[model samples]
Target: MGSFYVTTPIYYVNAEPHLGHAYTTIVGDALTRWHRLLGDDVTYLTGTDEHGLKIRQAADAAGTTPQEFCDRIAPAFQRAWERLDIANDDFIRTTEPRHHAAVRELLQRCYDAGDIELDTYSGKYCVACEEYYTDDELLDDGLCPIHKRPVDHFEEENYFFRLSRFQDRLLDWYAAHPGAIVPEFRANEALGLIRGGLRDFSVSRTSLDWGIPLPWDSDHVAYVWFDALTNYLSAVGFGDPAQDHTQRWPVDYHLIGKDIIRHHCVYWPAMLMSAGVELPKGWAVGGWLLVDGEKMAKSTGNVVNPLDLVDTVGVDGFRYYVLADTTYGSDGDFSYDGLVARYNADLANNLGNLMARVATVVAKKCDGVGPAPRADSPLADAAAAAVAGATTGWDAVSPSRALEATWGLIRATNAHLEANEPWKADPGAEVDAVMGDALEALRIIAVLTHPAVPGTAAQIWERLGMTGALDDQRIPDAVSWGGYPGGTDIVKGDPLFPRIAS
Candidate 1:
């Protein structure tokens, strides 16, 4: 069995889970689900980044201890995932004992390599971001680019990582491994940062009391990136070198937002090199989901609560929009009008309409029993083309493209049914052949679309009288154009997607 590992950025628990957090987790969930359908051994990991200065400040305002605050907010993430049907294999929190052990081991390895050293630093800091910014990075009013608020000046004694020393090594690595950073444009951005000159980054903070203490020195705690990034390895048993992280480590991919491409594509690779570990196979950078041409933010009160959408549109409906609307690397705008439009067009019209029409025809014309498809059906050719297109899109980690390709097959199947009009014909070999071809197309669609809209896909599978877990079906092969064995009972069930008023 081939093994694959993928992760979402561990979300900071200072706020409740938002659509942005849900977006990455759902993408990871969809990719892992796709891999599983291909018969690969997959590990999907996501969790909360509980230990950080931001969390400490939020806890103070709430009149609670940091741990207590985290304990309360962490469940929001887990519950959200559950509600969204996210199939993550593990949820690792930085506060977990296993995670703490792994972080210390990783820090010690880098420390012994002379990559970490004590230093004094002063800069404009954003408490919300838990990061310092240079004057050039700050706005005219000394505000953080992301938060758009005045940053505070802070000075402290801290341990720094010698990131500047590895600039040449990082460039060399990127040279040998092209396309390591996605979209080609993001790769150029990373190269620009490296050529501009790398700066040594502080890895520990003296003023924060809510983070993991430095293993050798308890006076300070590990900074946000160091503590948070370690969750990827720590979740898979990387802390204990003797443990078999070989099954999951040297991760196949790290899915992150485009804003953090530098950290994941640049600083992260350098940190791994300093620890004498192999780098991740790839970095899949995604653009932000904007609302009204602005990035979603809590302070601005523009954050879209994912649950609100889930309540309005079902879980699968929300999942479908996120995966189908955005090109993986390009920024996407989110609007209620857009969601409802997609739900009506793709779900209520295309997929749901196709399923309902086929089942209704089978019930009326074929005594509620599906017949076998003809040997030379045109629907077979369309299914083959759709499968190929979707497989290529998934390989590139573009969920939107994959869904688009899959929907092409769906629309084609609907067109084929329209050309034949099986409902208008008598119950005979001709009607059986046409309806049979449509049923076969539905089967392939159920398997191919299982990753994006799992609940709805399974419903289609059962409506066709198929057995076994829909998720266990392998891709390309499961959708191999002519796999539906006919002469099975078909049921005209309730509408898969009820139309929602705009």
Candidate 2:
């Protein structure tokens, strides 16, 4: 089997999980599921970035040690993933011993390569951002543009990474890998930043006591980028240079938010070059999920608790809204009204209605046994086309496009059933042909759309009297024109997504 590795940015464990966090993890989960359907060997990784100044501050605010605070907050992320049906292969925490070892090794390699050197540094830093910012980057009154807070000035001795030296190399890599950064516009943004100029960034902090200590120089700890980025390699056995890390060395994709495009696209590749490592295969950047046209933030008191939505809408309903409503690489507004509308229109009205209608007709007209679909039916042809679209769309990481394409099959099936009116037609060969085709369409829809709306899809599969894991079925083939078997007992279930009145 071909190999595919994907990772979501390990979340910072300074706060409770929110809708933004859920949005990215769900995307990763859906992508992983799609790859599995294609019969590829996939390793999906996500976890908490537990060691940082932010975590330390959060711990101090809670009157606990950093480790104790991380121990508590990290589980919140794990539990949220479990509740949301995230299927990550591993969750690597930065504070874990394996991660520490990897960070030390990566730091030492860059230092030994003459790219890391001791330097006296002085700058205006944003505690919220955990990075220094130039005067041009600051807003009026020298505040952080993102946090809208005043910046702090400090002078200290630190170790700096020679990022400026690799600007030409990064430009060359991007030139060779045109599609390395996604959303074309974002790629342009990264290129523009590189063209503007490059600066050597400090890689060690003497002022922070809550991070991984620099290997050769014990007085300092590795900074955020150096410490956090190492989690990707650490999880894949990077510290054990004796072992071949080639299997997982070149990550297929790094799914990150647009806010950190500079860190991932610019700084990361430069760091890899310094250490003589292969760059990531690609970077898939997604925009923020805004609430009421404002970014979700704790200070704004606008952060939506993802668990509350999951409880109300159900996991699959929540997942479907996240993937379908938002076009990849664009900001999506979240509201209770919007969520309810989508759940009702797409889930309850379109997909759920199709399943219930098919099963009801089979039970009433076909004596509760689903007849095998006719090979030459028009419904089968339409389903085949929809399945093909879904396969291609998902392969491109366009989840919204994939779901829209899959829903075309749903719409076609609804139209076919309405046109034939199998329930109204007399019980005969023609009626069986129509109902049979509809059942087959349901089967195809179940397999093809399972990645987006898994819980409801699996339920529909069971109601149609199908056996085996729906997830195990291959894409396109499972939804192909002629795979539905005949003469199976049809079981009708309650409305999969009951509509909520507005």
lDDT of candidate 1 over 332-405, digit per residue (tens):
99999999999999999999999999999998998899988776888888888878888888888899988999
Residue-level lDDT tens digits of model 2 in 1-502: 5888999999999999999999999998998888888888899999999877888899999999999999999999999999999989999999998899889888888998999999999999998889899999999788998989999997999999998898889899999999887777888989998998999999988888999999998899999988998888888988876666678779988999999898999989988888878899988889999999999988889999999998888999999999999987888999999999999998899888888888888888889898888878988668767877887777777789889988999999999988888878877788889888888989888887788888888888888888888888886467678787988898877888888887
What is the Å distance of residue 186 in model 2 from its true position? 1.3
Off by over 4 Å in 2: 241-243
Model 2: how far is 28 from its true place, Å? 0.6
**lDDT of all predictions, in order shown?**
0.90, 0.88
- Which lDDT value does model 1 have at 482? 70
Backbone clashes under 3 angstroms, per model: 0, 1
Best by lDDT: 1
